[model samples]
Target chain A: MLGYTITQWLFGILSFLAIMFALMVVFTRNPVNSVLYLVLTFFCIAGHYLLLNAQFLAVVHIVVYAGAIMVLFLFIIMLMNLNADTEPRKHIVTRVIAGVVGGVLLFVVVGALKGAEQLQIVQGGASQIGLVKNLGKVLFSEFLFPFEIASILLLAALVGAIMIGKRDTNINLK
Target chain B: MTAFIIYKAIMCAAVFLLSLGVAAYATLWERKFAAFLQDRKGPSRAGPGGIFQPLADGVKMFMKEEIIPNVSNRSLFIIGPCLFMVTAVMTSVVIPWAKPMMVGGHMYDLQITDINIGTIYLLGVVSIGVYGIMIGGWASNNKFALLGAVRASSQMISYEIAMGIALIALIISSGGSLSLKDIIEGQDKGFANIVWQPLGFLIFFICALAETNRAPFDLPECETELVGGYHTEYSSMKLGLFLFAEYINMFISSAIMAGFYFGGYNFPFSSELYASLGLQEGDWLISLIGFGAYFTKIVLFICLFMWVRWTLPRFRYDQLMNLGWKTLLPLSLFNLALTVVVEYFRGNIHF
Candidate 1:
């Protein structure tokens, strides 16, 4: 029970941390700083996943998002020479439009929250569904089609990416 | 409860101190190893057989002045080395050092925690390890540092996939458990994993060499190209820390390789040794003996690491990338497929 209480406290602290880092990801002016903040946010979310007894999900999230993707983000930001404090200023009209879009999104989110359903808390062994064996079984059996489709979509995206990333060299005229 | 807590604390201190101590000596060993390879005298003035060279090196590092460049981000410059050292230290946790020992009739494990998903945890932390170099190099704001950082990040990212895939093959071959203790114990029961997963071991070893930034794969900090690489702007103990973390990383990686492929603390004649002595397995006596064998294996690995370092020249960056992505990655996947096919043929694999 003491350990359980500590876990709850940790979850609360980590949720707050995740939100703060998420905000920092947007607010940071430096692209590298923003990417680092985003990585911190990913780690905080990984902590939340761990708190939910989803160890595999937490680790995979770290490995893929924080580890690989954010490192690439840092790499790209560095290679493009984007670290200088030289962000172009937005036009007044553009800022106003962005503000309006943000306001609308916030309102929509709040309105949806007004009709939120009651929380369904399952008893013992519910969290065990996050274990690798159980998760894999569910993915293969119940969610097989969706899983296959998602992978196929990812494969198509990968191929499209290669095509996009390829340099267009002009051929010599014979 | 107090005893358990005390034991855990002691184990933590022991593992930490052991890693630092071994890292210190590994530096001396590396020097001596290089000298032996090159047929020259190496640090004979420090102590007998250069045994005290690490201590002298430590003192020298401490005495050096700490420097912060005017353009460098001060806070991040400091955090970079500290983060690198912390990640390097943390990786030793999942490795089971020896068999469980008996203390006052309570069985005490030499390992910190035998958690499930240990290898995944290692992968995750290792992925995060790139941040230290990235932050340090970026904070330096120097072109060489930046290039080095970029190289380090890309190199780690490329190698980690192959490393993880190779590990997955091992996991499949070793009954699909993600725990190191299970892997090692299973290995101890039979021959080492090198028997079944030789190709996997080779792939893992190469990836490990790349991962630890050892020679041939030392492109990130190659002196000729990048001028000390990511630590170009770093000075004093901060520099010491980055260097320390590398050696510490080498030690941990070697230890892990031993555990996963070399039967951990188990020797081939360990059971026979026990039988001759009329002692049971899993006893503290056996545990101590196993620890002795484990230490020997670790020393041999450290030697191997140093030997390879002195023997091979550093790889060019593009060549490193090609080896990682084209060669090792596919080879690991093929090994995984071969494992699956064999397991299916052996009638152990199920859908």
Candidate 2:
């Protein structure tokens, strides 16, 4: 009834659910529940990517974020044996400071978006840009340098992680 | 348009029933095969060679006492096996079962959807599959379940990397398209990807085993230690769902392996046979034969899975981790590089 197409309706529903889940992530007291909510939020965002016809990006987003990173988050939360009862309470002053920091961040984000133009949904024959072949061509030809740099950055992080992990083990063994 | 929609609805129902039926029989077959290996006859009393055994098992699972632990997270406990079964069934959507069938001047695809990113979609769904185990285990509030959940997640994650890398090499060789249809078509015209990509196939097979939580990597639900593992607290139909989902996953993975490595629905000299038999393209009989070929490959792979399950002992947890990280990861990486080099030399890919 809003004069929206099916895709547009889907977009609105996904966006609404995304924000709801994102809010739940912050509101949930249990760390595991928080992580799961965040995962739901990520899935909603990925749904938006799919609606935008970015199939590769949508699947990769779920694989990398919702699948891999959130699993690690769950692992840490589960392994640490943290529960609402075991969760340490912050002092009143500390809570106040954290709230102030979060508010400021939100304010900054809203301020930055205040002057942005409204985005138009591109409708027609499905966009080719999101398909794997075209995306690969664009990535390798135009974005090659930036992509390589990103890979190098990731390699550095990997090396740093291994070194840190090995150092402690070495000390313990010695 | 209505006809097309009706066709798709029928196709979906068929695939759903097919997966459920295969899973049911797989359980019986697993028992029969295990019996053969151990020098005993498996369940022969029910309807000749235990043909109705799966039905009996279904009834048993349905009739068992439903129990939810008092301390367990009620909602999540209910959600666990349901999620597992849902994800298990969801993966078959993109798989092309057989060649398209022509009806009333239209060629209907046997697959539910042929998305271009089919490979990654499989990986994504499989990665999400771990959540079912994780949530189920965590909701149980039992230490054993928690440990099993942790192992399942870690093991699946580790093996997934190798699996994706191994698939990358295969994709590079078998046309760069990510669609399963394209990969299968590539094989239909030429040799199956298995000839050149044996090592890649082996790596993928191993990773699939670990990902599906089959034996040798079935540490997540190993009975000796964890006493049912992630499904320890699950009872009756809930436990049945978890067990049923594993067989479904096995069937799907076997179909995928058949599609990826073996010529999916394309036996050797199939076109020659078709031409000699004077069969036209899109003929129902041809499609049926192609489907028979596909089914044979899947059955063979399932047998191999069952054979290994009965043959090999379960890997120690440390050894499983070591093999996934230290061995298969590097081996798959090597396969990727090797495929790239060979493809480049073959003039199939430009630098």
Query: Top DockQ: which candidate number?
Result: 2
The Cα RMSD across the true interface for model 2 is: 0.6
Grade the docking of candidate 2: high
Give DockQ: model 1.
0.82
Q: Residue-wise lDDT of candidate 2 within A1-174, one digit each (tens)?
A: 679888888989999999999999989888888998999999999998888788999999999998899988888888887888898989999999999999999999999988577766457338779877889999999999999999999999999999999999999999
Model 1 clash pairs are none
DockQ of 2: 0.84
Clashes of each: 0, 0
10 residues in a row with least lDDT, candidate 2 chain B: B220-229
lDDT of 1 by residue, A1-26 (tens): 55567777887899999999999989
Which fraction of the native contacts appears in each prediction? 0.88, 0.80
lDDT of 1 by residue, B1-351 (tens): 999889889989999999999999899888887787889888888877777899999999999998899988788888889989999998988888888887777788889998788999999889989999988998897989988888887898899999999999898888888999999999777779888899999999999898899988987667765687899999889999999999999989989999998999998977888899987645778888888888889889888888888888888888999999999999999999998898788675898
TM-score of each: 0.94, 0.96
Q: Which lDDT tens digits does candidate 2 get at residues B137-234?
A: 99899998888888887898999999999999999999898999989988998799999799999999999999889998888667877576888899
- Leading candidate by TM-score: 2
Give the TM-score (0 to 1) of chain B in model 1: 0.98
